[model samples]
Target: MEKDLKEYITPPIMLIVVLLAISLMFIFPVLNMIILGAILAYGIRPIAFRIQSKLKFSSISILLAMIIVLIPLILLVAYISFIISGFLVGFFSSNPNLDMDSVISQLSTYIPQNPFLDKNSIVPTIQSAGKSVLTYLVGKLGSFANITLDLFILICSVYYFVKDGDNCYNFIKSFVPKEYNDFFERTVESVEDVLKSIFYGHFLTSVIIGIFGAIGYSLLGYPYGIFLGVITGILQLIPIFGPWPIYWALAIMDAIGGNYPRVIVVLLFGFFLSLIDMYIRPAISSHHADIHPLILLIGFLSGPLVYGIVGFIVGPLILGITYAILDSFRKELQESK
Candidate 1:
């Protein structure tokens, strides 16, 4: 009896062990990149296929489609870098004093005169805190090499994912059961739709908002108005809180510079730009995919947490595919029962 029990349990335990070992070997890092690559490929493959049909050559079509997608992204990044460099140079070269001594003097005088007065020690503490913040910023900016390498890795990874996307998807899908091929195909379609909605919808909304923002800022005579507008539009891709911070920062800067009329104009411009999210995102996403906005919102919020920045695209595709597969399986189970 003991021997039989042992024999009965051994194979199943071994199987479990083997599966766990295999998963540990290939799962973590590759999983995120593979998922990201698959969604990107799925979105762009149709365009590549269309180009292929028109040009009657697969390689040329692939190349053209890739170039079309990559060129704008490259140009945008270059422009943003140029703007950032200029801003940094201007800021440091101005040599404007922050008036810390006057602030400390005011605090010391005002607090001592007030009924709430324990100002003796607080003044030194406040000065120390200010100096600590300055020291932190200086230390952070000193690590330029690390920052540059990280950025380079991000760009290269994105490029490689885009270039070899089809192969990546095919490799991952090979794991699905043969009997579940139909379900697998549908899941792939759903994932493709979700990714398309995210990528194209976000891109279209950003461009529209940027155009309106740039026009408004130019009219208001803001220096670097187009750059600020573009920055705001790009930041709109961040979920939960979008471009509000950028607009608010610009408004504050304008206010500090005594351009109150420009502040009002910028605020109104931002208000109009905010409406574009309502009009553009839903229009583009709904046209491509019939996904619930709540689901997309969940994807957008949870994505970065799970997969770093790439998760923003990967999260929704994963949720869509899981929903598709489970729905199909449930239907099948119901029919069988």
Candidate 2:
């Protein structure tokens, strides 16, 4: 036992462990960003390689690939922010002397009156809730510097991961026992499939659905249709939430405003959106690994709570990859037996 302990846990190993612990302490704050970067790199690598073949320069290819993948994402976020701010500014500016009672009375016109329910009382509650939500969002936005730093780190991490992913994989492979080399290779392939499965099944589906939503809403003559579509797409990414919420909310608003015809139209459009997802998701995901919906559901629901917004991407991918590895391990065990 003493000899085994000395052989396995020598001074050098102890020193390495101490160094790793210290390194983790520094990275713990931005670990989520780093993980997200690596995942993004996996998606970007093929694009980088394709670009490299044409550009004949590895660095330029990687940078261009990053831009290709990331620019739309950055623009989407910026556009969403712009729309939200613009809407708020327009609403308040246009209604400088906004009358709460008048608004309530207008709403009450389309709403069925109930003697027990006081519509007037709900106005204060709604105002308080809106204020609280706005304050929370503003407080989050106040951490601009930290957000910038994390983004910088994420970009750097992605660049290196895409550029040197092979080296990283080889380094990790070196640590695996020769007997487990086949297992490691199989696991790697499985993980790749998992990544593909999630990217195509979830993200791509959301994008398609969002496009459908944008066109439908615009055709329906809804203001800010693009923003509504974008929100619908984001909601589609979460298992518990889907295009239903957006259409349902719109329907409710239209109903209250006495636009009953538009409400029915939007509801039908939303149902079409949902129905296509049943076909689109399976078609895109069928070629790759099959990850359980439950795993993704847990990841999507729990990821944001732990890692903030990026968790939406990181959570499901991480869980899917973990599942792949475990499944690979099980196969290896069965083969051995």
Candidate 3:
């Protein structure tokens, strides 16, 4: 039976419209989960495949990969959470040694007197504001349900992305016209390169700095050096201002506590790490994505402000692809002329 052209075109057109409507309905999610999942899938795909070759089971290989990747992440998050909770508990407790009156007096010294505002009233005003914020947040505890749902979605998206990423790519590519397949392929390669450079580049640098920081802190006799180093390494994901503030803050505390020698040592090690950031990151990432560090830095800063945590990854990815696509389009036009 010969189908009419309307029959051939109508289904696909309707399917596309339905998909578009569904996407519009869920657009509030921002698809950060999928983007993150894709990046993770791409990074870990080779390792997963190699493991599968040895094991002769894709499912088991994927399980092993997930364990390898997720366990550490879970541990890190748990550890940070513990540290934060402990700090908060200690801070809020009414320990006799805390001496809040003296602390308030010390804080008061920093506030300059203004003609419009009373110097004595500033601390109470800040305290009132803090209490109001605390109350507001305490009332919002119910919102944790939403955060949990988002995390669940993220985890599931990552799992599926890893499992069916290749199939999904093919499915998407099938929609492209054959005449533009070459351009599409080129764009994919370009985007892939940029993602690898940014994501893997940050990952590699973070591990290096984290390990180095751990070793340095341990040698310098800093307490909980490994934990602090781990945190430091994680913070390296922030560009231009990676982990320096933490080190500086620690050094200031140590100096105040009369550990001048230790402070100097920490500062020197931090400076060395800064050099690695300046040299190694650019050297590795430039081969694939020769973008300015400022682009990434701005992305990290403004991404969180706009799109939340996922913006850190997506911001650079979006900027890189936008440029690459524009360049490819220009080339295609020039060639046609």
TM for every model, in the order presented, reads: 0.68, 0.89, 0.84
Could you report the Cα RMSD, in angstroms, for every candidate shown? 6.0, 3.4, 4.4
Q: For candidate 1, what is the lDDT?
A: 0.72
Worst 10 residues of 2 by lDDT: 117-126
Encode model 1's per-residue lDDT on 217-309: one tens digit a residue. 777777787887788777777656666786788899889989898788778767777887888888887776666666767877898898777
Ranking by lDDT: 2, 3, 1
- Comparison by lDDT, 1 against 2, better one: 2
Q: List the residue pairs that clash in candidate 2.
A: none
Candidate 3 residue lDDT tens string, 157-232:
7667777888999999999999999888888877888787887678788888888888888888877788778888
- Give each model's whole-structure lDDT: 0.72, 0.92, 0.79
Would you list the clashing residue pairs of candidate 3?
none
Q: What is the lDDT of residue 299 in candidate 3?
A: 77
